[model samples]
Target: MATVENRQVVLERYIEGVPKVTDMAMKIGKIELKAPKGSGAFLVKNLYLSCDPYMRGRMRDFHGSYIPPFVPSQPIEGFGVGKVLDSDNPDFKPGDFISGITGWEEYSLIHNTSQLRKIQPDDAIPLSYHLGLLGMPGFTAYVGFYEICSPKKGEYVFVSAASGAVGQLVGQLAKLHGCYAVGSAGSRQKVDLLKNKLGFDEAFNYKEEADLDAALKRYFPEGIDIYFDNVGGEILDAALLNMRIHGRIAVCGMVSLHSISDPKGIHNLYCVVPKRIKMQGFLQSDYLDKFPEFLEHVTKNFKEGKIVYIEDMNDGLESGPAAFVGLFSGQNIGKQVICVARD
Candidate 1:
């Protein structure tokens, strides 16, 4: 079989503090198109690669996280959509469309077939949505809100990083559940996107708010009943002060503290005692059994125009480093995706 050139984004070393594009380098390598006999690996041509904040954790040498750290001088692996080119595994065959964890490269030879999921294409929905709305981000929002927060109608819901992948969906889901929804983003544009485009009842630029506690109080006069936290730090501390009795806080990604050497402690955790609040940290994989139900509901809402998904697409493998780095800086307006190939 002929060997083809494979372009990849490789981590140069373990990252400290916030990540930069310089931390990763693009390298070219060659690979055979076919999976070797008895290898049990499937060869796939990656289509869209997702750039998520969680990936920042993998860039470090941390051992406590659910996913392992990225190996130095190797392709950074994350969620991506791909089309099968060859397979030694019976479960996946040539031309099969799948989305899961794959290397940030033009093509990947996946040995762990269990992580890959077959994509049943819907012409009405773009295939790239598999990396965002119909995929992990959407599922994360679903599980965090329903399973973790247990939101009810007429409750006040607030989402940090509101214009982000998971936050945007959580706010929309809160609104759909007949709860009052509010979101906070880093910029005015993203704040506008939340209130104007994403149907959040209220949205604010947290960077502009000098007093976050006052900001939360201004938006939620009755106190927030459900807080879907994405960017943890002072915002979480402020939210704790404004939470109503028996309020629930779903601890999702803490992007603000991810890169901090010594993360600031949350001072208002004592409020949880007085309010009888429930704050829980969760992972999407914990709710895998509910994926089928989540897919059906979210897909239906998407097709009916009841929900909207926004994505910031950076084209080519060359753009992967910048796209990944942009997450920490809040440079993306929505879900950050790198389009590596169409097929």
Candidate 2:
């Protein structure tokens, strides 16, 4: 068999307000498909890469973000699961499955083998689940809900962008915990996905609602105790006014604010002080030490058929750029995955 060279998706420029196709470029490049001897590195055949809203932040030149911006003309990387083609690293061997930060390319020479996790085959979940339900987004939802929000049974919980990757899981987790969960999305079909498929108690289409505050009030008649915020700007402002005393807010991502400069500011700052509401922003990496516990919890729910997940897939590495841009526009029905090269 002929040795395969990698095809990588590279960032062409740092985005300003919103990303465009012109900011990214995918092209072929040469890479060793096999791991070199005694290098403590492994070679992986990239199968799936997650498309996340947080990646949009990395596209811009931002200070105080979780990581530095993706340099121009460099291969973009994100969470992915891959099959080991060869391993000079003792922890992983050829044919082993793994997940972590991998390049948006056909293959990768991963030097920091310790950073990559070896996916256990004994676990009855699909390997791809490691990138979504069993991965960062899932952990984000779990930690945000349990640690950040700290809900009581029968308390009202609200999730914005609830049909998207992290939002869907947050709604389901809240339901599992006995909280009344409501979600908002951009489309009627997504609202259906939340209420019908994901088991959210109620869902509203933001596009159809003339007033976001009225919509939140209508659903959360008693005021919300916990709010898992995914879309910020106006939604956050609306949620702030509707929060109960001692309410908690977990700031996940702000997809609504990502596309615009001078985003709509919240006018209800007084509510936070009087209500004693706690609002916090968290990164998934901050909870990395708890991943094993999260995997155990989310996996059990999956096995017991207590959870439902949906994915919108785009085929091939070439489609990656457009698929990522679609996240900001709420084009994806569920979690977005770019199928770089199928195993």
Candidate 3:
């Protein structure tokens, strides 16, 4: 193994409101890309990087998040697809494709080779898909729908942020399970893509509807049996009022509450008593044991045209900051990815 030098994107400081360019910075440095002698670690050449809303939680100076905040003046890390450049581990080899936790840099020395799975490139799915459709967001959709929602055939399923990475797949999965599915998104284009392109039974632009509760009542006049919630706050409050008996609600992420001072309060909790609704918050990590089962189900659906995926990719690592900040503004149409090195 040889020493290697690489350039990386590092978080410069903790941010408030929307993050500016100064919040993160880039640096070039020298280091051994290869693991230490006899360390059994592998070095990876970074490729596609996922820019997700959840990363915002990691940027704040808080201890309540699932993960710790990024240290100042260091490279921020998250899920990324990469190819192995050097290896001292038995399970991984040079040139093997993988996707897992890595830094926003050109190269990373990933220890604990057991944590990185070798991706079969011949599967014909995009390697980038590992970050979205066939990855965390995909698993989030699967667990939330089948396990949390406990959906039944012919039931009505309502999804908020329906055109997003997780929401799109959840709606499609609900359809496959014989449920009537509808999605609400922020833009008209997303609404069209949901109903006309993604096979959602119905779709609406939440921005266009001044009254969310009124809008939900119109779409689910029969009442909602399953609510796959991605954006909480007033939306959650609205959905609570329209739930059917023994309804299920999976709280995946609360993107709406992330940037605000005081989050919207829910006032319709009384409906839960009469409906006996099951509302549970979940993290994708909680269902890692079901990864193989989820992969099989989602891959079959993808090949059969029962599921479709969308990605909004920017060209370089330098664009990572803006691409991430855009999630709050509804700028990305689908999963947001940043391409640092394609080959």
Candidate 4:
């Protein structure tokens, strides 16, 4: 077996509030390019890594989350697309591409292949899309919009964090379902992308809106049939106020509260009863049984030009920390993916 130097993004310490690049340090370690005999593990070279908002929860010392916290001084784990190099597992073999939870490093010895999917390479779809458009974020948007939102044709839908990884697809899926889709993003650029590139019916810069309630009213005067709440805070309150009768709210993310120590409460709880809105929070992990169906739907639509996905890629393993921290500040335009290595 050959020994190789592996460069990894290691967490220096568990964090509080907003994350900083200094909290994670890049370190070099050596690994044998082989999976141990009878270990049921496969060694892989990570190609692309996903930087998602949920990773912030792992940076804290909380164990109550759906996922476990990152162990400090180790390479923090996330979703990645990798190429198998050596395998002690019969299901995976050398030269196969797989996507699942892997370390933020050059090479990973993946132990649990239970959730991992073997990718049959398609030239029409980029391999990196496995971490974004065809992966967890895409699946989140699918399950949330179709299953949670329970959307109907001609319904009015509003998506917060609109141009983000999950929200972008939500808005598009709503449009495809014959609904009026609107999205709210932080910047004018993201707003433009939402409306023009992603085909949302309308988009607004949330930062420019002084009153979110008024903003929602303006966009959804008849009231929103579905509200994809990505940034919970004032936006959620506003959505609550504007929800039509029997409307549904898919609570996707809380990027707004990651940096806040003292977060404010939503003031529109009473509206839920009066409006009869169905609001639910979900984890993509919960709906693992539906992954194959989701993949088939997305891939077929994507191949037929009925669906499109956008990604904001940062190159190299060394850039992982900065790319991750940038999520809090909304620096990346779309799905933030770190290209650790390219085949």
Candidate 5:
């Protein structure tokens, strides 16, 4: 069989802090179209790759994380949508469309089919939505709000990093559940997007606020019933001080602490005792069984114009490094995606 050139984004070394484009190097390699014999693997042409905050953890050296860290000199992997080219696995046939953990490369040979999901494309939905709304980020929001937080109607809801991928969906879902929602973003544009476009009850640019606690108080005079904590650090401490009795806090991401060598501890956690708050951390993979229901619910809302998803798309595999780096710098307005190819 003829081999094809594969351009891949490889981790140059174990990163210590926030990942930069220089930490990853693009290389041109070659791959056989066919999966290795008896490898129980499948070959795929990557279409779209997702750039997420959690990927920063993978850039570090392996240290007993829930997911294994990416090895230096190897292709970095993340959630992506792709078209199957060749398969040694019976369940995945040639021409099948799948989405899951894939390398930042033109072509990838996926050995584990367990995480792979077959995509049933619909004209009503964009294929890239699978990497954002209908994919992990959307599912993360759904599970965190509904399952973990157990939100109620008319409650005050707050979302940190509100304009990003997961935060955007969480705010919308809170509104759909009849809650008063407020979101915090890094910039004025994202704040406007949260309030004007995504239907949040209120939104603010955290960077412009001198005191985050004051900002939260301004938005939630009655106190927050459910806080979707995305940024963590000072924001979380502020939310801690502002949480109502029996408030629920769903810890999603700590982007602020990801690059910091010495992470700050949350000091106001003592309030969780007197307030009887339920604060929990979660991974979306914990709620895989709920994906089907989540997909149906989100897809319906999306088609009905009840939910809106924004994406910051970069073109080609070569753009993967910069796109991934942008997540930490808050350069992406919404979901950061790299368009590897169009199927």
Candidate 6:
């Protein structure tokens, strides 16, 4: 097969503070469509790319994190949904759709297939969902709420960044488990969705609150039994003060602090000691064994209309940079994804 041009979203340089679309450049590159013999790799035509809050951590020059920093002048890598075009592995075939770590480009020559999952296309489930609802974000929510928070029936649950990919599901799960669920979002539109669409017991616009602690108190008059912290800092500090005795807190991503070079600490953390709050920070990768269970559970509830997922999609790979940058500012309504190509 003749080599073809692959348009890639490459990191222009290592950046500090909030990321801008300018930090990445769209460069046209070339690749062979065929996977080399005995290489055990597959070649895929990228379809959808995920723009997650966690990717912000990879834009730096740090090396200590679980995932390495994105190489400057190279394609920014993230979870993607793709169709297999060529393969040298027995598990995958030429027509199989896959979801895993893929380059943010038109096509990818994937050598590492460790995290890859063979996607069986369904007319009911949108292909892009593998990058969001059934993807890392959704899995993260399951692990955090069920494993980390250890939620219970009749508990008072709160989720910050409530309209985001992970938070939206966390709030819904809390409600489904017979808990009083409240969520805080950045805008009124999102807050409305939390109440009217996502089925949260109550939703608030955190940006409109004069005092976050007071806002949480208004919503959770009995104190919170579980607090799923997605965006850290101020909201976390507020939730700390509102936690009930023996409450549990799941420290998910600190999307609020990701852009900060020197982030401020929560002053109310001392409340954790007095409240006996079980606070834990976690990564979804820690619970890979539960993936089959997670998939089965979410898929069933989703199909029955007991659960719903929301997404904000950007068409074309050229829109990748702006779509990613939009995540930090609450510009996206739900799961932010870039549609690279249509299958």
How does each model score on lDDT? 0.91, 0.86, 0.86, 0.91, 0.92, 0.92
Clashes of each: 0, 0, 0, 0, 0, 0
265-296: candidate 5 lDDT, tens digit per residue: 77899999999999999998998999999999
- Compute the lDDT for candidate 2: 0.86
Candidate 2: stretches off by over 4 Å = 122-124, 255-262
> Residue 65 CA error for candidate 2 (Å)?
2.5
Q: Which TM-score value belongs to model 2?
A: 0.95
Error of 6 at 331 (Å): 0.2
Residues 191-253, candidate 3, lDDT per residue (tens digit)?
999988899999999888899899999999999999999988788888999999999999988
Error of 1 at 11 (Å): 0.6
Candidate 2 per-residue lDDT, tens place, 1-343, comes to: 2377789999998888777777899888888677778788889999999888778777887767657788878889789989999888888888998988898999998997545788876556766777888878888898898888888999999999998889999999999999999999999999988889999999999999999899998999999999999977888899999999999999988643555823556688789999999999887777778888888888889899999888898899899999988887889999899887767
Compose the digit string of candidate 6's lDDT tens values, residues 186-240: 9999999999999999999998999989998999999999999998788889999
CA lDDT for candidate 1? 0.91
lDDT of 5 at 287: 89
Tens-place lDDT digits, model 4, residues 1-343: 9999999999999988789999999999999999999899999999999998899889989898677899999999999999999999999999999999999999999999766889999999999999888899999999999999999999999999989999989998898899999999999999989888999999999899999999999999999999998888888888999999999999889743556722677789799998898999898889999999989988998999988888999999999999999988899999999998896
The per-prediction CA RMSD against the true structure, in angstroms, equals 1.2, 1.7, 1.7, 1.2, 1.3, 1.1
- As for model 1, its CA RMSD to the true structure in angstroms is 1.2
> lDDT of candidate 5 vs native?
0.92
Q: Over 4 Å off in model 3, which ranges?
A: 1-5, 113-115, 259-262
Task: Check candidate 2 and list the clashing pairs.
Answer: none
TM of each candidate vs. truth = 0.98, 0.95, 0.95, 0.98, 0.97, 0.98
